[model samples]
Target: MKVSEALSSRRSVRGFLDKPVDLDTLRRVLAFAARAPSGGNVQPWNIVVITGEPKQVLVNAVALKIATGEREFPEYTVYPEALPDPYRTRRFGVGELLYANLGIPRADKAGRLAWFTANFRFFNAPVGLFVHTPTYMGLPQWADLGIYLQSVMLMLREEGLDSCPQECWVTWPETVRRFVPIPDGHLLYTGMSIGYADPDEAANRTNAERAPVDETTTFLGF
Candidate 1:
């Protein structure tokens, strides 16, 4: 697919069909994604692709934690405790939009929790990818990792596959580390769900709105 086409079509797909993604297809996507630029050629991102029994193991562990009332502190704060201005308003709007699409009213706390829990299940996708970076890395390296991840997501779009880049994995980092055997020096950054999107799912119909270019970017040179 053309880069523009891929960029325009790509969305964070929440619900996926049960179809499995072949390994060869996944490898090709990752190989292309690895070409993404990084600071000083330091390719700091490490990806663990989980499928089959191993993926189920991690999923079960997370469910167990939730059942046992065990909560993990996020490795990093995704958003500030107190967000200000347009960002805060934007976040609230997205939440409201998503819930509205699912017929989940703002006052239905239980319904919201149930939908949030779906993240741990890979949104019913067949493949799960966990991204990691060394704990010693700084902000620049983290930014580079994000670039690599975006490359992966876009590549998947080119392959007729869909994905959701989830920060929700941070809540079960230790369980993931143990199951995936991620080394001690590395920190689990995020998880991604990859597969064919369930076209019929109501949540899949909800797309987050983006701010206009004038609001987020400035063009200096004419």
Candidate 2:
């Protein structure tokens, strides 16, 4: 597929079919995605892919913790405690759109929380990936990781697969470490769910709106 087509087709797929993502396909995608730029070619991303019984074990453990009111402080803050305007509003607006499409009303707090638990389950996607980097990696390295993630997502689209880059996994770092052998002193940056999109699922209907180019860009010379 063309690069433009991949960019346009890629989405944060929330639900996936009961189909398995081929390991060979995933390897090829990652191989190309690694070419994503990094400062001085210092690619500071490490990934651990999980599926089948291993993935299910991690899901069940997190589920039990959630059921018992257990919580762990995230290694890094996913968002600002008090987000500023426009960014905060945009984030909330997307959530509203998703819930609305799922037929969930604003008043349905319990339902929303329950639905959110699906994040631990990879939204039923057959493949899961944990992304990490050394704790000492600074902001620039983190930014590079983000770029790498975007590369992976777009390539997945090219291969007729879908994915969700979930930061939610960072909330259960200890639980994730118990199952995935991420090396000591490495921070789990995020997790991802990969597989074919479930066309029948209502959650997949959320096509989030993007701000216009003029709203987020500046062109001094042009």
Best by TM-score: 2
TM-score of each: 0.97, 0.99
Q: Clash totals for all models, in order?
A: 0, 0
The TM-score that candidate 2 achieves is 0.99
- lDDT of each residue in 64-127, candidate 2, tens digit only: 9999999998999999999998899999999999999999999999999999999999999999
Report RMSD (Å) for each prediction in the order shown: 1.0, 0.6
Off by over 4 Å in 1: none
Give the Cα lDDT of each candidate.
0.92, 0.95
What lDDT tens digits, residue by residue, belong to model 1 across residues 115-167? 99999999989999999889999999999999999999999999999999999
Q: Please estimate how well model 2 matches the true structure, expressed as its whole-model Cα lDDT.
A: 0.95
Say what the RMSD of model 2 is. Answer: 0.6
